[model samples]
Structure formats: C-alpha cells, structure tokens
Target: MSGHGFHVHGPHDHELEHAQAGEHGGEHGEHSGMINQIALFTAIIATIGAIFGYMGGATQANAGLYKNNAAIRKTEASNQWNFFQAKSTKQSLAELARDLAPEDKKSGYQAKIDRYEKEKNDIKVVADKMELDAMHWEKQSDEQMHQHHRWAQSTTVLQICIALAAISLLTKKKWLEYAMFAAGGVGIIVGVLAALHI
Candidate 1:
C-alpha cells in the first residue's frame, strides 16, 4: 500500500482499522471525518514545507553568490592598491633622482614624478570605489543569509506541525490535533515573515 514514499495505510493503520470495525455507524463516521481532516491538514502543511525548503535553498545560494562577488571586488581593490603602491614607489624614486640630477635633467625627473602622482591618484580612486563595492556586496550577502535562516526556521516549524498531525491521526487525540493546528499557524506566520524579508 506504498508508492513514491507515501503509504495508503500508515504505521497505526491496523489500530485504526480495528477501532473502526468495532465502532457503530455514527462513531465510524466521526472517525472517518477526523482522518479526512488530518489528511487534508497534513497535505497542506507538506506542500508549504516543500515551498519553504526551496526558498531556503535559493536564499542560501544567493548568499553564497553575493559573498563570492564581495570577495572578487575585494581582490580587485587589493590589486588597485598594489598598483597605487607601485606608482608611489616610482614617484619616490623620481623625486630622489630629481634632487640628485643636474639642472637640465631635473625637469625630466620632475615630469616623471608628476605623471606617477597622477596615475597613483587615479588608481587610488578606483581602489576606493572597489572597496565600497565590496562592502555593499558583503552587506547584501549578510541580508540574504538572514533571509535564508528565516526560511529555514519556517520550514522546520512546518515539519514539526506535520509530525504532530501524524501523531494526532494515529492516536486520535483531539488535543493533539489542536496543537498541530496551532503549530501550523505559527509556521505560516514565520513563513510570512520570510516572504516579507523581515
């Protein structure tokens, strides 16, 4: 009575069958109705749980991607800073050469120093922009990770609700069913928070 990971009769199905057999007409009908209600609730919760699981996975992937992007931007910024340092070193050498050079050669060294200064400034601007971009990407990654956690929380709560539903169905406990519904409501509220990116 099983297909695709689902069983037509669950673990306590034998007990249920025995109880129904011994029950009179109205009692049997009531038991049947309760089973149907739980079945519907379980199905809905399972579906919601699946959706939440997928969202969690997607958000996790996005977080990873954003983190990688941040790393790349940081690397680019480091490279630009290295370029700037190289230019600074060159400019320092040119300044030293200008001080030691003859009067005619000093102008050439001074021109080289000026060119190096301009290039370093440009590199500094690019490096600073890249650093800012890296920070932005890191922030985005953090937000995505937070959302992923929210989705995971929602999914876990829904799983607990589903487990409660199964237990209620097996034990035929009205209180258990009520608890299952309460858990389901909590799960849905968490899911709403996730959707709103709270």
Candidate 2:
C-alpha cells in the first residue's frame, strides 16, 4: 500500500457507486409535508441563484468596460509620448541650428528652442495625466472583478444548497433536511455579502 493521495478502483466499484446514487434518488416517501417544504425551499434557492447570476454577469461586464477604458487611456498616453519625442527632436535641431548660425540669428533659434521646451513640458503633463487615468481605470476593473468573483462564489453555494435540498427530499431524512436548510441559510448570507461587495 503506497497509500498516496490517489487510489485505484475496479469497474465493479464504479458501477456500485452509480447504483447507490440512483437508489438514493428514488427513495424518500414516508415523511409528511417534508418533501413539499424542501421543494419550496429549492424554488427559493433557485430564484436567489438567478438574481445573483444576473448580478455576476453585470459585474463581469463592468470589469470588461473598465479594462477597455484603461486600454484606451494607455493608447492616448502613448500618442502623447510620441508627441513629446517629436518636440524633443525639434528642440535638438533648433539647438544645432543656433550653434551653426550667425550671432544675429542665434536669438531666433533660441526662441524656437524655448518654445519647443514649453511644448514638451505641456505634453509631458498631459501624458502623465493619461497614465494616471489608465491606472485608475485598471484599479476599478480589479475591484469589479473581485465583486464578480464573490458573486460567482455565492451563486455556486446557492446551487449546492439547492442540490442538497433536492437530495433531502429524495432521502426523506429529517436530519438531512435540516442540514439542507443550514446550507441554504449559509448560501443566503453569502449572497447578501456578495451583493454588498464585501
């Protein structure tokens, strides 16, 4: 017995497991009004799942929108940086021209260089702002993604609760039914927390 995490099973064992599950699904009919109550509770859980599923979809869409906005801002920032580079090139050329020109023309070249410098600074400020905006949008996308994940978790729990309730109805075991209710309550709490984005 290597006794690792994995185990080997025979084909007969697999069939037995399925046969047992099928038997379980067909069993419970002795309890009074128990199955009906479980069916009602299952309906309620399904409704909650539907609502949270919609919320998850919305949050996912919002996250995508924010991500797209971030990409657009980043593209705009790249364009601004390209403009800044062009201005820098022009300023370098103007400085070279001033160096080669006569003393009388030096002032004109100096003025061009000064204007280019100011333009570069302006472009830099705009590009910096665009970068900041992109980062902000990315942060917003991350937040929405977190909310979406929470909603997904809640929805999954609700699904589990519904499945448990169905199983309880089939088995007609009072203890199992109570367990199903407990699971449903936990699912409700999780759903509410997801709605709160916590």
Candidate 3:
C-alpha cells in the first residue's frame, strides 16, 4: 500500500500474531525452566553421591583400624594368660614344697607362695585391663560398620536418583522429575544422618 510496495496486516491480524507469539514464549519458558531444574538436580545428585562414597571409604578404614587394634590387644591378653598359667604352676609347686619340706624350708616356701600370689594379682589386673581395651576396640569397630551401612544405603538411593534424572531428561516427564527429586531429598537426609554417626 505504501511506496515500499509491501502489504501490512490489519489490526486484527496484528492481535492474532501477538497472541501466538505470547503462547509460544510461555511454552518455551516452561520447557526451559524444566531443563534448568533437571540440570541442577543432576549436579546435586552427583555431588551427594561422591561425598557419601568418600564417607563410606573412611568408615571402612576406621573399621579396619579398630579390627587391627582389637587383634593386637587380644594377642597381648593371650600372652598375659600364658604368663598367668606359668605363675599358677609355680604356685602349685611352691605349695607342694611347703607341705613336704622341713620347718626351716617351710618358711622359705611360704615366702615364695606370698611373692607368687602378689605377682599373680598384678598379672590379673593387667590381663583384665587388656581384655577391656580389646572389647572397647571391638565396640568401636561395630559402630564404624553401622555408620558404613548407613552411608551405603544413602549411596544406593543417590544412584537411583541419578538414574531417574537421566530417564526424566530423556522422557521429559514431570512426574519422573519430581520422583527423582524426592529420592534425592531422601538420600541427602540419610547422608546427613550418616555424617552425624547416627
């Protein structure tokens, strides 16, 4: 219509064009928001999985250390028991000598019995303390194992969340996305508990 020789649409046409543009823009925004959220969720899942994996490894190491310490304590306790048995044999022989010896030798044997009794008591105290130490190490090992179990559970859940996230991105299902997020939330909570050694 103008000197440029190009036709311009009427007001009605302009209104229809604007409406279609707005609809398309809205759809694009919605889709982009979903993609952004999925990306963020995937990153969070990967991070949680990594942290829990490290924690699991640390717990395993602690358990092994405790087991080694327990073994050491047990060895020491066994050695003490062997020494205690030797003392017992010496005590029996001393008693037998005291009962059969002359009166002059009897007093010497009595002194030996007294000395042996004191040594046995000392050994008993040391042996009991060593056994208690071994039990403490065993208990610590159990606690580490329990914490490791929690970390393992959290790691599994995080892996599931990651898998679900992958599936969601491919299928673009909002339900699947939400489910992935839910699983990730659970995994995070479990990881926190494990960190707290609960």
Candidate 4:
C-alpha cells in the first residue's frame, strides 16, 4: 500500500496469476533433468582437475624432500669427518706435550683432551638430530603423495557413476532424475573446490 507500483487486483489478475503459476510449475518439472545433467558434468570436470592438481603438488614436494634428505645426509657425513679430524689433531698435540714435559704436564694436558671430547660429542649429537629431522620429512612427503594418488582413484570411480546416472535420468525417469540431482550436488561441491584451487 505504501509503494508507487502497489495496486488492488480484480478478478482478471487472479485468473492470470493462476495460469502463469501452472505453466511455470510444469516447465520446471520438465527441465529438472536437463539442469541436473549440466550440474553433474561440471562436477566431474572439477573432480578431475582437483585430482591432477593434488597429484602434481605431491610429486613436486616429494622430489624436493628427496633432495633435501640427500643434502642433509652429506652434511652430516662432513660434520662427522671434521669431528674425527679435530679429535686426532688434539690427541697428537697432547702426546707431543707429554713427550717434551715432565710429570707435572699430565694434569693440564688432560683438560685439553676433555675439552676436545666434549666438542666432538656435541657435534655428533647435533648432526644426528638433523639427519633424523630430514628422514621424518622425507617419510611424511611420501605418505602425502600416496594419499593423493588414492583419492584420485576413488574420485574417478565416483565421477563415472554420476555421469552414467545423469544420462539415465533423461528417459522420463522421475525418481532417477531426483536422485541424479541430489548426487550431482555433492559432485559440484567437490568439483568446484578442485577446479577453483580451493
């Protein structure tokens, strides 16, 4: 009543509204199958795209992690080598000192030996921990890559079923059409996410 377009309709308006409603209702029922088909097709494409993207990412991460593990192993080996070299040099110096001095030199030479031992032990511990960390990441990356492959396989099966069901709905099968529409909705959600990189 407050709007400029507002008007009180007579009997003619009531008859026209009823006719239009019936027409639209029948048309909607007929077009439901077509709509479901389009939706299901879109979803299948999205699922495929998502699977590819996830697999590609997994492959890249796996390769990178493998390289990282190799580098970490090499570095650990280098640290171990350096530790042994230093230890040997310290022992030779202590031996020389003992040879050139008298009995009083034993106490001071023992301290230098202890210090070198501590340094070597600390280096070994740190290198071991780094190697462990690298191994953990490499394992995790492999598991994730395998998971992506599994998901891709499962989605392919589901996509095939949905596409076939959508086709079946076109033959005046009302129940199948409704089922297809419902299934297609699930596909769309998964497909759109994969397609859009969500």
Leading candidate by lDDT: 1
User: Could you tell me which residue pairs clash in candidate 2?
Assistant: none
**What local distance difference test score does each model get?**
0.93, 0.88, 0.91, 0.63
Which residue segments of model 2 deviate by more than 4 Å? 1-30
Residues 1-198 of candidate 1 have per-residue lDDT tens digits of: 988998787659977776677465566678788898989999999999999999999999999999999999999999999999999999999999999999999999999999999999999999999999999999999999999999999999999999998899889999999999999999989989999999
> Model 3 clash tally?
0
Per residue, candidate 2 scores C-alpha lDDT tens digits across 112-140 of 99999999999999999999999999999
Model 3 regions lying over 4 Å from their true place = 1-24
If scored against the real structure, what TM-score would every candidate get? 0.86, 0.81, 0.86, 0.49
lDDT of 4 by residue, 1-198 (tens): 236878787899877786676567765544664665656665765665466556656655765777677677767767776876788688779767867778798778877877877777877777677777667766755665564454454456456546646566556565765565565555445544444444
**Model 3 poorest ten-residue lDDT run:** 22-31
Local distance difference test, candidate 1: 0.93
The alpha-carbon lDDT assigned to residue 61 of candidate 1 equals 99
RMSD of each: 9.2, 13.7, 5.5, 10.5
